[model samples]
Target chain A: MSGGLTLVVALPLLAALILILLSRLERRKGAIAGPGFFQRNGVAVGLYLAVAVGFWAFFIIVLPQLAMVDLSFRPKLPPSQMGGPKDIFTLENYRYFLFGSTTSTANWNWLHIKAFFLSIGVSILITLLNLAICYPLAFHMAQSAPVARLRVLLLLLIIPYWVNEILRAFAFRVLLSSGGVVNKLLMGGGLLDAPIDFLGNDVGLYMGLSYAYLLMMIFPLYNAIESLDRNQIEAARDLGAPWWHIHAFVVMPHAKPGIASGCTLVFMLSAGALAAPLVLGGPRTLWFTPIVYDRFYQAFNWPQGAAYALILLFACIVFVLAVLRMFRLSLGEIAR
Target chain B: MAAAVELEGVNVTFGDFVAVRDANLTIEPGEFFSFLGPSGCGKTTLLRTISAFIEPTRGTVRIGGRDMKGIGPNKRPTALIFQNLALFPMMTVAENIGYGLRVRGVPRHERDEKVKNLLIQIALPEHGHKLVSELSGGQRQRVAIARALAVEPSVLLLDEPLSALDLKLRQHMRAELRAIQKRVGITFIYITHDQGEALTMSDRIAVMNAGVIEQVGNGRSVYAEPRTPFVASFVGENNAIRGRITQAANGTATLDTPIGPLTGRNPVGLPAGDEALIFVRPEALKLGGDPPSGFEGEALDVTYEGSITHVTMRVRTGQKITLSLGGGAAGILPQPGDMLKVGFEPQDGLLLARPERS
Candidate 1:
């Protein structure tokens, strides 16, 4: 592709590797925080600073050198003669979304607009759904049950994750197809008059997508909930807080990290989710990932695809960082 | 007036294992009662039964002259401060203190007023707004107390609450807990495995072992006139001397043994033919020149323990007996293998029935 695109991917990888290597080093090295990082085998601390600096440095190199083409004119075709003669530094591509203006289109207008809006909607939807389903489940799984009961349930939760993620997604695909068990049951039980669209629809997309990523939302929430001291609940109970009051005042506040992490996980996964939504959502749901995919693979528009992909990658990083910030989790803090 | 609690024939069995069996005791209202024993001695099991955490497998638990059948922990008029001091960490000091009142639907203003009073009662009037996490270990302990007391239960149950503190802090908290109990004037059922703690704080102490109450009386009575060998040995340190009875009469028993005729006070219910153990409190045993009328012995070893010198001596029967002598005692210090005489009054020596399989 372009030098800017190459640097965007390579810089973080190189930095992470170097940071990891520095972790194995003695206190004398000057790779990162010098004494602070090198003295300790604090791999996570090293990685965090390395990743943050790497992202910042990569952005410095790419943002100025990258080409931004304005396609708000009549022609919806990409010109072969682009990013060569004109200035590399342009804010026109960003301005279209942030500040809509009067302009002429001369590029692939429909693809960019569709990809941008779809990514936003999908990310928001997934985050909300994950919050809805996982919050109480994690809370219940953590606090509500007696110790003996939750022990077995936790084993059940820990089991499926061991079976692998892709297998779980593919299993959802089988369940949501037109002639799958769900549709058959619906028709057989007279819940539906006829077999309607199950696979390759929004319903299928949500079902498959949520199922595949629920564990990601669940484990962190469970850990947060599990770590909450029961003394807090008993204290609430002693304080004359009814059951609900205890949950609202005592349990929820401590679980802020779990909630943030769960939301962030679903947002990151669903935004660029290629497999489940692709398999279940079919052709109509052109996610931003696949849009980038088409340019890179089908149209051979590597530079343009890299640009869009960089935007998606950058957004994920910002969203994750924002959540981490809210929870007061530094790179070191969020480490397992 | 009805007793605050009457546990009659209370037996708690976990499957084949008996935690507490045939426990019978009556705790008068406002009495500072303690169940003291070594670990796994079922003292805590009895305490838990009284608190309604574990239902007695048999017998009756009575409170206010009412049988406490099917009365769960929350339903019972008792506030149990768990061993771990399960204070809610998410709440502030005042919030924790007012928890009991709040749960009882007491209004916020009333809860606040009561919590304020409790904070003062706990000697921390200014800590109400502070988070529990901010409090020191001792402060957290006080907060746990204030919260339990805020419930205003007629009976307060403490399950080894002072076990977590360091030795010096534990000693301080022990005094503080006793003072608080006295101020509140409620029936405090304290459970501990510490003998010294029980003797110091308890109005009446019940010494339990192997799911049964070995002996129950005031601390002095349990310590002085231990009815069984278990009570005598377990309640406090005592030198046990084994001898067979030769002459038995009213309040006097002469045990015929190798050490010559050893005189001991007759504890009631000891038959003449029954094999008995003579228990002598350490300080009571006198070691010097002439032994009492019919006693003679040779000093084996003497160990100085700052306050007292522990003397070990062998009598004519070849059995060695130990005694605690005060450091300031005006006498030649007995050395190892030195020939001397040791004697004790009959009141100081008690004959105990053999231990019953525990």
Candidate 2:
């Protein structure tokens, strides 16, 4: 079945490649047979590059995604009963997502649904918060800071990210614990009356997620803002614009592509995050990915897990499209 | 309305490098003044000091008789046109022009009206709705000017704003800029390395070099009567001869050189036996005329540039001197390796003290 599915997808891609090559050859009709064709090695190199990339993309990315989507529609059954009538295609797995069970309960899976929405909402809040913290920092690094200092600043930002993500999340868990250094410092400084329940209230998760995705937000913003001519800011100020107006009218508008790319990346990563939630989530902080994890590993139900994963993927796609539309940016622009 | 700008004892330093040192100048209201110098000559630093972008390490800037000690660029009554123009690419031409008004909380309609007037004033009425990136180079230049003009600044500062354009457009923009400055009746402080721009458009030009103001005067006087050796060499193409003063009296001195003793106007009146340099402009050298000082050289190259011709020669002292001949002058153009005689009148040559080694 997997072999047949691979053929079904591969045939169309092969045909398209042949058609493109044929058209290219047609444009250079006599040149292909001429001595000049052999001298110009770029065409041959490009063809080989394209074939290599296409092969890797099809096998590595497209095939696994197609398998998961196909698996989402199949019934979960024992291997001995795989070809039996009970092993037929069904919407039972998807229905389990909407309702609580395969048998009609007439009841919604409010817990999972609520977790899904909460994950999305929190991810968005984290995205905005990251943007707010990173914008001024990126601007300073790109424009105002001296070159030597900027190098030091970039090193400081990058050195922390060298540690593994899960390890960093675990480190945050320790830091935000009741008897952690942060609480001790606050109490010692007389800024707080007592230790705050950072872990119990999900503040640790928020901090962990924000810290994990900060570099992703800052680099793009820095790249975009650095390309801006310093003269434009001076011109705005010379025209009597205050600092805020200069940013709103000149800097921010120029940085829309970077902002869009950064926000989308941060949001998607935050939503699909498993390590941060597992490490830092409090007792009351229920997340959707863990439920999907349970359906696959704990319950041994691949179909239901696939269905839930697809729903999350669909939601992420919708989000990316909405962000692209809101920012008036093309996919190509953000790719840069 | 226009306001006078005064920079008194201004100095700017970046670490140990002095960018501008003790710059003192008073720019009259409604006057078109220019800071003319080569690259890294502290002209831009002086201009920024006046515009309040950079505060002088020591000294004061006064605008319209008010001390601008702690004033920021946004609060200053001056606008700067950057070298690259720096038009906002995301904003339409009209929006870019009216940005200052919008920041001041002018109503939308009022801002649009003012933008429309500025567009017409800049001769870009139809381009108001176009993005700055969509306009041609000259149009963007006009938009930058209009954006600066929208706030009705008492002083407009330009930093080599024409250096990016092609020759024809730069020449056209120079006339256009002069006309706009005159029509608006505001002080225009223009900075450029191009002496021609300063000579043609400015009411007065300040020649600067090595963190010092060398000379400041009307263009003709600055050109004909430079006060320093640096000013003489920077302002125009000149044949410089190194010598020691043999005789000095009555604003005239004789310099003893490798070829012969040459006499010229000694504006600084260096005494006898002092080392001096004499500068004679290319145009001032006559090809074959009886003059006070003369040299015979072999012609190396001759270039004819429409209205004028330049004849380059290597004199007996192994120094190259250029002579400019008017297009109307009927003479045989000399080819390479041909012997020729060149001379300049004493009054046409300028004698000044030799610059000390840095």
Candidate 3:
């Protein structure tokens, strides 16, 4: 309902409309080699653009987003009590998220804010951890291994990812539990006097999330690193560069787009993940998705849930944009 | 400060496959040495062993009289310009050239100064700020060479670095590379499958085949007096005549071939009744010759190639022999299907024992 939000949604639509009008005008003016896919493939590209804009944009993205925005700006009411004169569109849900509920009497609620920041911070940490864990493995799989061994390694990496994420997280849950294998092994080795509380805190959740998206982080890196000419590395070595320098100056810069892509994907997914947190996190661990879950299911507050979900989506978008900027890459480059 | 390279009985094998077998070579300092062969001839493998990229399976490699048994490529007094050039596309031309200096902890000011001087050396002085991807293929090649030379290695190993360039640029670079090597006065070991490049650029050429070095000599010697059948067949085009030695006398063999009796210098000196092959350059055979011996055949085809006319003839026994005559020999030009007499001086023909069929 705000002018800013309206403009944010309308800017892309306006650009698309301008492009379509210009293309039509150019078509009427006569055939010319202008910069448009429509000019190249003729009516087929126009038909493709029409289908994409008409069906996918409307049904998948724009319509659902509009519905969410509408829901977020409305009053929450039961079905029997809905559509009454008293039930009016309001900013109560957004206000309730920013401040506290009416009974709290606080100027601004810190719990939701703290939870959002904590989730974002930890998601970033998990993304970084995944990058560290997957980079060397990806490099080894892509370059160091023989072709036959590389196939076996790729199969091992891919096969684990084929298991559902939730099941994988539960498996982590079992391993990270107090009486789990990790703790037993540690205790048996006399490294610890007592069982560590991995799941009781968010440690288990972080590990589970990083492990759950390990393949997503590895594949993009593998594809990028694989394209690097092995001769470059050997040339660097022959030029008297140490191994670390070779990676720092040659390999890492080459894999930047993949790193950005993997980080963005892992950050977005982990930030919005619900199951890992629910399964592996303790009651005190207040991840933002659990709050959204609480609002929609437990408190039966659809508007508040929509508000939280939209805010999380916006945060993820900002993160992706920031990462793209930091890596000096476009979405197109990352997609490659 | 150039260094000589010595490979003493070096053998490199990977699993069950022998890449280089019993190689012994000594490359004098400041000499342009080239390994000439077809692909999979182990020329590149031999070069890598000298550069210490791969350790020899059996013997030792020495550079400037220092044993190179345990030295890696980084510590060796040599740098390799890869076959692909391998210019770091992410770096600017100056950065790519300065990388060797930078890694050695050289100060930025010194590195930049050296890089600027190297840009001039490669004749791309204005393109230092440009990325490697922006340069033409030949320019990238120069940058790669300059980058390797920046480290001041006493020996430079080049692995077919000119293979990617177009023909004209490749020929042009052959002169430029030789000039640079001479200016630097470093031992240059070049690898290439193209014999033209090897012959034109190298001070000495080692002809290799099937993991074995068949012969090592100057370009003229290798071409004029090849010791092995493979070298004679590989180094240049030759007209091969198979025969059995009927008489051996004073380093000359008289062979009874399908084309008729022929006498030539016999290096292998197979005894009487032994199978042999005599090879003669196309230019050595001439039309309407009558001394020692000659072959009478029907002229099958005549191809005029600028300064010379190549004539293909089939003798009565049904073997093809090709001869090149001077283009100005218009009066002597034989038309196709006409009977022609072609003969060569006994000294121009080289006779060797027949190579066993694989």
Write down the TM-score of every candidate.
0.79, 0.93, 0.92
lDDT string, candidate 1, A109-214, tens digits = 6656676777767777877888788878788888778888788877887777786656766777687777888889999999998777756567777776777688
Native contacts, share recovered per candidate: 0.30, 0.93, 0.83
Candidate number that wins on TM-score, 2 or 3: 2
Docking class of 3: medium
lDDT of 2 by residue, B211-267 (tens): 999899999988999998888888888889999998899999999998788889987
Per-residue lDDT of B10-78 in model 3, one digit per residue for the tens?
899999999999998888998999999999999999988887778899998989999998988888889
Question: DockQ: which candidate is best?
Answer: 2
Better-scoring candidate (DockQ), 1 or 3: 3
Model 3 misplaced regions, further than 4 Å: A1-49, A77-91, A102-105, A188-191, B1-3
Instruction: Kindly list the per-residue Cα lDDT of model 1 for residues B240-351, writing each as its tens digit.
Output: 7766787788977877655666678886747677677788887887865454424567887889877889888777667777778887663667778787777788878888
Q: Which ten residues in a row have the lowest lDDT in candidate 1 chain A?
A: A68-77
Global lDDT scores for all candidate models: 0.77, 0.89, 0.89
Candidate 3 residue B107 C-alpha distance from true site, Å: 0.8
Chain B TM-score of every predicted model: 0.92, 0.97, 0.96
Candidate 2 clash pair list: none
Give the residue spans of candidate 2 off by over 4 A.
A1-44, A102-106, A184-195, B1-3, B305-307, B332-336
Worst 10 residues of 3 chain B by lDDT: B1-10
